[model samples]
Target: MTRRCGFAAVIGAPNAGKSTLTNRLVGAKVSIVTQKVQTTRFPVRGVALADEAQIVLVDTPGIFQPRRRLDRAMVRSAWGGAEDADAVVHLVDAPAQLGDSPADRRAQADVETIIAGLKASGKAAILALNKVDAVKREALLGVSAALYETGAYDEAFMISASTGSGVDDLKAKLAERMPEGEWLYPEDQTADLPARLLAAEITREKLYLRVHEELPYSAAVETTAFQERKDGGVRIEQTIYVERESQRPIILGKGGQTLKWIGQKSREDLSVILDRPVHLFLHVTVDERWADKRAFYGDLGLDYDA
Candidate 1:
């Protein structure tokens, strides 16, 4: 049998469940999931094998109105992911788009912006209405009809990424669209993210889960060292950079309890994913200008000037 391989860019607004869907398709956690918006800062490529086809899923950061340099860079990366893809899936929060809340309105607006961009690019995407379990069937049909009428999408799929509903069907569709070619990655490889970068992302996820509301948007995690020991375990050192001196104590907590908790949680997750014991150390630092540094953006594969 001949092999097929191609790229598929998953683009959507903040909190639209793109990462969740990508993980589902790849059958592994390639991107981190959290309750906060804009959690993903770079494009994560997850490899999924469907029979003879290899689908490279590009999970891009949430597209939103940019106010900061980092925000602009993330949005730019999102579009760049789409420009080079053989297929594009624009995931939307269906329930939110059908609701009247202020947050829902903002989500609907973002979806419209993506639709406009699709039209301008002369690309017909496959619209995937996510969170279908939360919305009524009629409401979903209405939303799907409205979006399809825009002539920007070639097909529509109502799926719940969290529950695995309608995912296999979507995967089959994506596989059918893949062009015939040689496999881009090994069959056993689930993701293309490097170990050091994945470690940093895992710690960063813990940080946001612990101090999301208390900490500002300037927090970043860098893995300074990752070493394999003779005992077949990994030793990792990471630094969590915050924008203010006052934020350090908050992350450290009383008697260093908070930082300890974060480190413990991160280590546990890493051990399970890596299938080995992990010794993780976390330090909180004050770097008010970390977001402005070019190297910081380069590390994450984002263009700093964007």
Candidate 2:
């Protein structure tokens, strides 16, 4: 039997559980997830090997309004991820559609945007009503019906990215969409992202957990140094750069409390992910124009011009 392989982009609005879904589908945590919106800023590729099929899952950033250079790049990557996809899964947060909530509105807008993008590319997509674990079956039907009206999605899968409910079914459908070909990656590989980028993503996850408002978006993390020990462990040094000096104290908190907390959390997460003893050194820096600096995004393995 011939093996199958292709790209499947998981595009969705902010906090729509795209990262969580991607991780579940790949059977590993390739992207970070938090309660805050816009936690994912780059296109994270997670390779899923299911029954001799290779599904490269593209976990993109939340599609929303662009207000800054970084935001523009992130939004660009989100849609751009769908360009060459063999399958596009539009994961919509069902609960947000109850009223005139921003997530509800964002959900509508992003669906239209995805439709436009797909139309221009002459491609069809699949709609996945995510977070079904938190809502009712009837409510999910409403979201599915509304999105199906777009005439852009060929299929709809209601799944919960967190509770592992209905996720395997969606993953199987996505895997079946792969073109007839050999596997594109090694069987053991789960992601195309480099370790440094994964390290930065882990730090970004901690930052999003510790910071509030738009601070998480204005800040970027970079892995400055990484060393592997003789005992097969790793030592990593990271820097979290905020766009303004005033934001520094907030991240640092009283007596360096917040920064310490963030560091501990990041280290704990990294240890689990790397499966090794990680000596993580975290520092907070103030960069008045880091967002405007294209090189900064490039360092994170992201497309600055996207």
How big is the positional error of residue 229 in model 1, measured in Å on the Cα after superposition?
A: 1.7
* Number of the top-ranking candidate, with lDDT as the measure: 1
Question: For residues 18-89, could you state the per-residue lDDT of candidate 2 as single tens digits?
Answer: 999999998988999887778887899999887978999999988877877777888888888888788999
TM-score computed on alpha carbons, candidate 2: 0.93
> Which lDDT tens digits does candidate 1 get at residues 1-306?
889999999999999999999999999989998777889999999999999999999999998888999999999999999999999999999988888998998898899889999999998999999999998889889989999999999988989999999999999999989999999898999999899999999888888888888876778999999999999999999999999999999899899998998899889989988899999988888889999999999999999989
In model 1, residue pairs whose N, Cα or C atoms come closer than 3 Å (at least 3 residues apart or on different chains), thus clashing, are none
What is the Cα-based lDDT of residue 187 in candidate 2? 93
RMSD to the hidden true structure, all candidates: 1.1, 1.9
